[model samples]
Target: MVRQILPISALLLGSALLLFAGGMNVLILPMRGTFEGFSAASLGLLGSGWAVGYVLGCVFMARLVARVGHIRSFSVMAAFAAIAVLLSLLILTPWAWVPLRALSGFCFAGAAMIVESWLGERAEPQSRGRIFGIYTMVNLAASTAGQLVLTLGDTTGIVFFVLPAIFYCLALVPTAISSSASPRPLARVSLDLRALWRNSPVAVFAVFCIGISNGAFGTLSAVYANEVGLHLTAVALFASLPVLAGALSQVPIGLVSDRMDRRLVLVLVAVLALVADLAFIFLRPDGRLENLVMASVFGAAIYAMYPIIIAHANDHAAEGSAIQVSGGLLMVFGLGSIAGPMAAGYSMAAFGQTGLFVTSAVAHVLIILFGAIRMSMRAPVHEAEKAAFVTVPQGRMATPETHVLAASPEEAEEIIAAEEDRLAEEGTGPAHEAAAAATAAVAAATERPPRVSEEEP
Candidate 1:
C-alpha cells in the first residue's frame, strides 16, 4: 500500500492543500459577511454564484485542460483562486465577493479535477480502492482542519482571507514541483436529462432534491449558527461536524443500502433528515449542544443520500455506462445546487434563521414523496443486481474523476449484466424500456458500439 501510494503522494498532497483552502474560503465568507452586515439574501447569492461557476467548470474545465495541459491548467486555477481570495479581502463587499466567490468556485473545481485526473492515472487497478479511500480521508481531514482554523483568527480582519490565499498558493507547490507525468485529458460530461429520468426516476429526483436540501444547509448553516448567537468555536463546529458525521455515517448506510432496495434506504434516510429539519424549525435548538447534535443527525442523512442515489442509478443503468450515469446525476445535482442557495436565502431573509430548515424540510419531503411513488412504480433491483455502494464525498466535491476512483470501468460493466439478463427473462416493464433508451443514448453520445451480449461478463 505504501509503495502503491508513493507515486501519487504529491498529487494527494496538492489535493489536501487545495481542500484546506477551499474549506476555509467557504466558511470565512459567510462568517465575515455576517459581520459586514451583508443581507442573508446576498450571502445566499454568494453560494449560488459558487455553484454557477462550479457547474460551468464541470462543463468547460476539461476543455481548458485539453487546451493547456493539466499542469498549466492547475497552475492557472491556483493563481486565479489566490487572486479571488485576495480581491475578496480588498473589496469587502457582497457584490464583489459574489463574483469573486464564483471565480473561486471555478478555480477550485478545475484544480480538484486536475489532481483527481492525476490520481486516477497513477492508481493501479488492484489498489484503486485503497488510493481513493486515502485520498478522501486526506481531503476531508484537511477541509475540516481549515474550517476549524478560523477559531484561532479574527474574522473582522484580513487574516482569515489571507490564510486561504496562502493555502491556495501552497496548493500549487506540490503539483508544480512534482515529478509525475500529466494524465490524459479530463472526461467530458454531457447532461442528458431525458435519458437520466428514463434510466431511474427515483435516482434523478432524489439526487436533485438532495442537492437542494444539502445546498441550502451547506451555504446557510454557518450564517444560521451566527444568527443563533453561537460563539465562533460553536459556529465552526456547526459547519464542520455535520460533514464529519456524514462521512462516518456512510459505512452503516452503505451496508444497509447494498443489502436492500436502495430506494427504501433513501426513503428512510430522507424521513430521518425531515425529522431533523422539523426539529430545527419547531424546537429551534438555541443551545450549542442542541444545535450541534441536530446538525450531526441532519448531516448523516443528507450527506449519505448522494452515494446511495448514485448506486441505485447504476444498478438500473445499462452495462458500460455507469460513469456517464454518475456524471449526469452530478450535473443534475449541480443544477439544483445553483438554485437551492438562492431560494434558501430568500426564505431565510423572510422567515429568519428557521427558514433554512424550512427550505431543507420541503426538499426532503419532496424526496420522500417522490421516492415512495417511484418505489410503487418499479420493482426493486434485486440484492444481487445492485452495484456496490462506494462512499462519495459531499456535493460539489465530487467530479467525474471521482467516479473512476469509485469503480473501475470493467468492474462497473460486469456487476449487473447477468442480473439484468435475468430481469429481462422475467419480463420487461417501464424500467426495461428506460434502461434500453438510456443505453442507446449513451452509445450514441460516446460513439461506441453497444455491447451485443447482455451476459458478456
Candidate 2:
C-alpha cells in the first residue's frame, strides 16, 4: 500500500488540499452567516442548497468530464469553487450565500469526482483497497483539519474566506501539472427508484431517514453551539466530532451488521440515536464537556446508519447491481439531506437550538418503525449471501466516483446493464456506456480509458 501510494502521493496531496478547503467552507458558511445575523432557519437552507447542487452535479457532471477531459474539467470546477468562496464575501446575505453555497457544492462534487477518477486510473487490482483506504484517510483528515483550523482564529474576517480559496487553487496544482495519464470518463447514474424499492424497501427508507437526521445535525450543530454560548473551539468540535465518531464507530457496527440481520443493526443504531436525542432534550446540559459527550453518541449512531443500510440493500440486490444500488440510494440520501436542514431550520425557529435534534429524532423514529415492519414481513438474507460491509469515507459528500474508485476489479465487473441502457436513451453517447465496460476494458487492456469518440479540445 505504501508503494502504491508513493507514485500517487501528489494526487493524494491534491485530495488533501481540496477537502481541507471543503471542510473549512462547510463549517465556515453556517457560523459566519450566524455572526452576520442570519437566522437559524435561513442558515439551515445552506445545507439544503448544497445537497441540491451536489445531487445535480453527480447526475450531470459526467457528461461535462466526458466532453472536456479531467484536468480541464477539474480546473474549471476549482476555479468556480474559488470564485464562489470569494463571491460569498462580496454578497454577504443569507439569500446570496445559499445559492453561492450551492455553486460550491456543484464544484466540489465535480472536482472530487475528477480526483477519484485519477486515483482509480493508478490503483493496481491487488492494491486498490489499501490505496483507497489511504485516499479516504487523507480526505477525512484534511476535512477535519480544515474545520479544526477555524478554532485557531476569528472567522468573522475576510481572511477565513480567503483561506479556503487559496487551498482550492493549491489543490489543483499537484495533479494538474503531473505527468500522469488521463483516467476514464467519469461514472454517472440515473435514479431508478422502483428498482431500488424492489431490491430493499428497508434500505431505501432507512437511508433517506438517515439522510434527514445526518443532514440536520451536520448543517446546524455550529448554529446550535453558538446559540448555546459555547466557545468557538467547542463549536468547531461540535460540528466535527460526530463525523469523526461516526467514521470510527462504523467498524464495530459493521462487524455486527455482517454477522446478523442488518436491519437489526439499523434498529440498534437508531435506538442509540434516540437515546442521545432524549438525553439532549431532557438533560439540557449547559456544560461544554457534557454537550460534546452526548453529541458524540448522536454522531456514532446517526453517522453509522447509512453504510449498514447500504450493505443491507446489497444483500437483497440481484447480482451485479451493487453500483446502481448504491447510486440510487445516494440520490435518495441527497433528497433527504435537502429536506433535513429545512425541517431543522424551521424546527429551530419554533423550538430553539434543540429543534436540530427534534428533526433527527423524528427521522430515527421513522427508521425504527419502518425497520420493525420490514423485519416482521421478510426473512433475513442468509449470512453466506450477505455483502461484506465497507465504511463510506464521508457519507455527506460521497460521489458515484467514490464507489468506482474503491471497488475491486471483480466488483467493478458486477455492475448492472440497466444503467448503460438508460444512459444510451439520454444520448450521453456510447462512451457514456456502463462503468463496468469501462473498468473491464481498462483492466484488460490499458488502465487509461481510450476515448471511443472525439473529446472536446
Model 2, 350-413: lDDT tens digits are 9988999889889999999999999999999999999868788753568988887777666653
lDDT digits (tens) for residues 1-457 of candidate 1: 7898778888888898899998899999999999889999999999888988888888899778755667888999999999999999899899999899899888988898888877765666567788889999999999999999999978899998888898899899998887655564566688999999999998888888888888888898999999999999999999999998999999899999898989999999999999999999999989989999999999999999999999999999987778889999998898888888888999999999999999989999999899889889899998888887899988345887688667764643332243334335644555444444334433333234444446423
Model 1 misplaced stretches (Cα beyond 4 Å) = 409-457
Cα TM-score per model: 0.90, 0.93
Clash counts for all predictions: 0, 0
Let me know the TM-score candidate 2 reaches against the reference structure: 0.93
lDDT for residue 212 in candidate 1, whole number 0-100: 83
Error of 2 at 138 (Å): 0.9
- Please state the error at residue 412 of candidate 1 in Å: 8.7
